[model samples]
Target chain A: MKLWEQNIRKVKPYVPGLQPKEDNIIKLNTNENPYPPAPGVERVMEQMKLDKLRLYPDYDSTELVNELAKEKRVDPEQIFIGVGSDDVLGMAFLTYFNSDKPVLFPDITYSFYDVWCELYKIPYERPMLDENFRIVKQDYYKENGGVVIANPNAPTSICESTEFIRDILEHNQDVVVIVDEAYVDFGGASSIDLLKEYDNLLVVQTFSKSRSLAGLRIGYAIGNKELIEALNIVKFSYNSYTMNTASIVLGAEAVRDKEYFQNTVNQIIEQREKTIQELDELGFTCLDSKANFVFATHKSVPAGKIYEELQKKKIYVRYFNKPRINNFLRITIGTEEEMNQLIIALGEIL
Target chain B: MKLWEQNIRKVKPYVPGLQPKEDNIIKLNTNENPYPPAPGVERVMEQMKLDKLRLYPDYDSTELVNELAKEKRVDPEQIFIGVGSDDVLGMAFLTYFNSDKPVLFPDITYSFYDVWCELYKIPYERPMLDENFRIVKQDYYKENGGVVIANPNAPTSICESTEFIRDILEHNQDVVVIVDEAYVDFGGASSIDLLKEYDNLLVVQTFSKSRSLAGLRIGYAIGNKELIEALNIVKFSYNSYTMNTASIVLGAEAVRDKEYFQNTVNQIIEQREKTIQELDELGFTCLDSKANFVFATHKSVPAGKIYEELQKKKIYVRYFNKPRINNFLRITIGTEEEMNQLIIALGEIL
Candidate 1:
């Protein structure tokens, strides 16, 4: 037996969306921003002093949290930053989901939630989404150790309203509720507005989608100071300097340029609407998406066949081979021209 | 009572070296490289396309691992990258040190070892070092689930020979033996040389000390393919994209420029020699240090007092308040002028 095999947890790792090996491909599989980061990002990259890199970064990510607090209109103590939203959410799971009662989440949301639960040995139950790919608010009224819901749920691309989330929070007052808004910038109403009313609410957002800084690995959580402290304690024990200097500096600049962020978000929303209309015309069933991607299935073609055909045409979209959603394709909105190419290629494939 | 307070692991998080808020201070607290990164690092930063920030980085650190394998004379399959060495070692503890038998480490080794054990809920025993502060190889003859030793052990600054490490490995064939070479570039013999003879040995090194990339957050482990696969399994399950793109791109550049890495290492070794001689003249008991820093105690002065006096002079050195090391201080070697200033300040304090 291998020495490492003794205690290693056997985990089926979450397979991220296909990142194309070849360039010049109309990539729409991962829900990444189709536009470049804010113009200030380039400026931050240029102005960063390579000399200061000899020392460690600020252990608390003080400046980034301060800037985010300013933009989000919260106390600096309410923010917890990590390498990415996955890191933030993973740490949150370890910190708050330790009760003997089973934690809860949507069965078909971002797949990483279940993986984290397994990694930490947290008992969790997946509540099924309705046939319309929407969360049933009534199902979450039962007792749970904790809860997490991806606003504008992944792959399905349907978001629950802030009031619906608040209703769930109202019932689950004793347990922490995590609202992952990874793709909320497109059109979904954020639960950050509910943070004031619900102390148990933890709202997580990322620069990966709306701010276009996925390569920089910046993500954060906004919650009550007590919850944020719990995260910081775990983070400090795990790794003191989680964020690199380049990311902290550049992420701050990305957030500071609100106009550029808004413009890019607007462009993606416009393209998503156009793509939804085009998909409907092509005789496909498309969900009313509030994210950077559209969830659709052709009336006649199998989703796998469409995915394979799109690969041959150098266009990529996400397709899960799991039950209930195996027939659907989650197509990330790309540039208008790129989406146009995708549409033309799909027309031929069909 | 707060909902999360009950489950929160009441961990006294490891306190990292002070990162002073003000500039222009002589920072010798953390054993960070005094020099800047390779010239190629700047070029890599400048040439990185801002548009690529929209997409996620390669989850596996493909290019970075490829370049590192070439430099380290190992196969790409033998390498595993992390956010930093702390992140690397923490994951290793979670991966391999889970047998019912307790893991073993040096009593006066890197302080994070115990913290990691606590974080992972691993049972560990710290066998005491000899009075000379050298690891007694015979002490490790007993059975253990795993073993980790920081060569040129932190706060002691003493290195064990590769033959000595091999003796321990020879007995512990059923378990993994980890040799952390974080400061090995300063002068010590790297256990990387023993990888050919021992498949059970996992050697970890960092760019933070010798390559001047602490703020970049890059570290890696070299082991047999099976052990590496175990680490990758946990990493992929934990966080797919740990290293940000800039660290991956520039860390490769830092490794490729071997001549620059050698030049900086030599300069630090020279400064270390000069500082050790000077401290000896000041009636200090300095260890036979082979690392970037020296562990010393004044014959009559308290280590805490010296640390405070150095801080008042705007200089910093690490001091632990624990037993056995309470009287000693770990002083990182700085530029010649900075070392001279530190010596002058010590002379006045004595």
Candidate 2:
């Protein structure tokens, strides 16, 4: 009965984590930063003159690209920015992937990856993880149009080292490989250095996790000049002004202020470790994580029960009701006080 | 040789008119606002109490939609905003136009439409414009999955009246029809009213032209419940954060200050008439325009000569080399002083 393209009808959208309506909840479902962005980020917004907005923003986000180039030691031409890492990944599917070639990703990674492939009408194959919830390198050696894997993988919060990624690139020579490092700043190794060794590797990173500009919606990819140029061409042919003025300038300032940026991320890292310890002592089997969150499930109690109980008490954590992982919960690391509240809630729930 | 989706290989992007590199040119190439955005716009940016850029923005832009609904006198569910009209149109093509049916638009209109069709691999038919450089609405009724037209048509600056659009919507009952009113602010009639009777009509408009938010990257579509919901589902599955915060706030202000917006657009209308008069006096034929820009050709001089010679005198105008309209140039109406400068430059060139 629908008048839309048939493919769009079949696309089941990526469901982002719960955004609570009642603001009183602890609200740790999404892995958002517990701290504000770098102080310079706000200054960029306030100090920005409004007159410039009357003109089109640089299609490439020039200043931010140059800053990313310097920080990542990649050429400015090799960097492409989008609304977020999701947008970048979406573009990758529409531009590089197709109905003919298979898009390859981890079976148990960020759910949005599969959603994007479906939206783009690209045939995709999910490589299953090992029994320990880790990506098996041998699985990705199969032929694919491109390979995408998240580093410091979401939900599990465990990292597949850049070494494994370099080896994947070494083998998948005919295809483009994307390494999403949304949580790299929390301690996972970034594959930024592998750009010279592999021309096909596009390392996707975001300001959302580390730089704390998630609201600003800035994500970038650094790759071989050709692949980057391809993304640029695709952007121009589609929507050129994907990034707004405030988002661009503010993102650059946040990415450049490593001291203030690292201070906030490092705080979250410290909190994550302490929370993992607390959860472990509570008889939860937790993953060794490098992200701003921890993934764990208790031996005797359903994690979903704890999550719902915390929600009743005005504390929130993420619970996936999907099969094979219904008992686990993903808890984002918040400020010291917030984490302490979460721990106290867990104690009370037990 | 390039390793990209085959459909993307032939997408030639629309080259936008040249932008001002320095401050001192009589710039009228792109049809930008002769006036700045509403006073509230700048104030919103200046006083944006965003001490929190670390958190993700409202991906749905809920507050913006709520404000837009109030301004437009429609339900919040009726409006779907995008990064710009480009993003909106691109999403529309992917959602409603792709598949077995051919997407249709005017051959001479928004070149990006064809590019997007190619990007989505959507079979398309660019129905030729009438000799008068206006869209022939009847052409769109011929077995298309969707049809889009720029209502105050670009380059030629002629608008199809509300009655004419209603006629198209009457016959094309099955296919989706999009009326892009990107330049409707000067004098064109909006097709928004037809949304009452037609679930198929999506009237797309932008802040870039009349509202002067080109740099902000914001635009939206007003439609009946079903079409808007379709776009929402497409946006959710693809790029979720379609509009940024500053653009959302500023766009709402632009829509709210109807008097200011009307007065500015009316001034551009007056200036456009005056420019047409002066050009007619100097032996050039100009089209009757409903939009803010003017389209004209001189019998004695080449359009390229006029364009290049004007640039030599620090005046700019758009010159399209497309075979159908190789003799004419599209000039945007600027402030009175800028128009005077343009007049003097044209006089010297003639």
Q: What TM-score applies to chain A of candidate 2?
A: 0.96
RMSD of each: 1.1, 1.9
DockQ per candidate: 0.75, 0.57
* Global lDDT scores for all candidate models: 0.90, 0.82
List, in order, the clash count of every candidate structure. Answer: 0, 3
lDDT of 1: 0.90
Output the worst ten-in-a-row residue range by lDDT, candidate 2 chain B.
Answer: B2-11
lDDT of 1 by residue, B1-350 (tens): 87646766667688899989987799899999889999999988999999988789988888889999999899999999998999999999888887888889989999888888887788999999988888988878898889998997898999989889999889888888899999898889999989999888999999999999999999999999988998998887788888898898888888999999999999999999999999999999899999999999999999999999899989989989998989999999999998999999999999
Task: Provide TM-scores for the models.
Answer: 0.99, 0.96
Winner by lDDT = 1
The top-ranked prediction according to DockQ is 1
DockQ of model 2 vs. true complex:
0.57
